[model samples]
Target: MLNILRSHRISRFAVIGGASTLVYAVCALALSRGGTGAAMLPATAASVVAYAIAGLFSYAGHKYFTFMSAGAHAFELPRFALLNAMGLATAIALPVVLTERLGMPAAIPIVLTCIVVPLVNYIVLRRWVFRDV
Candidate 1:
């Protein structure tokens, strides 16, 4: 646990994830206050926006601090974007489905989805995007 926190890659990714969640929370709150319809749009938009910001940082952090990939930035960004799109979709869809369809508390699904997608994102990014192959 201590070793994982000490890792530069983990630390950087944690910070990025934290910041993105902050963005999502703020957007969700504002939208929910405005109207029910506004909530989903803003939530999804916030996830995409936050993911874009975090994705850029994750790429640089992973390249320099994690895997230290030798690939060109041009190649890496597109792959990163693609992986991020998948993660973003999961992040947005799960919360919406849980809150709207299942009638669960909105916060429950949001928190769970946020927690779950980062693990998936890390695995996919590690195996597919930044792999030595």
Candidate 2:
């Protein structure tokens, strides 16, 4: 009963979340690449831009595919955006604290963002942002 629904929901969430992750990684890595030339950006800056793009994809995917939400976009979108902004803040801060302050490689924060953001998002998205209506 509840377990079945939860299992099905988890699978759908994985599909959409995976896509969003791919979008974030591609954009972040691409933007972070190249030489010190103007075309390149610092890892944290690239991550910020990439996450913004990925967040939009995630909202659409989670709305239609993951949660199959039928709720009003006006209501759902604002909440969804707020949830993602928290994730974004964490994503932005990780590099600042980890790479800049601690002198860890940028990859560490980038990898942490990939793993941590989705985990937190799933919990919040299921319970709050895209809760069953």
Tens-digit per-residue lDDT, 68-117, candidate 1: 77877777778888877787787678656775567665556557756777
lDDT of 1 at 106: 52
Per-model TM values vs. the true structure: 0.64, 0.90
Residues 48-122 of candidate 2: C-alpha lDDT, one tens digit per residue: 999999999999989998888999988889999899999899879988898678877666777889899999999
Which structure among the candidates has the greatest lDDT? 2
Clashing pairs in 2: none
TM-score of structure candidate 1: 0.64
Candidate 2 has its poorest 10 consecutive residues by lDDT at 32-41
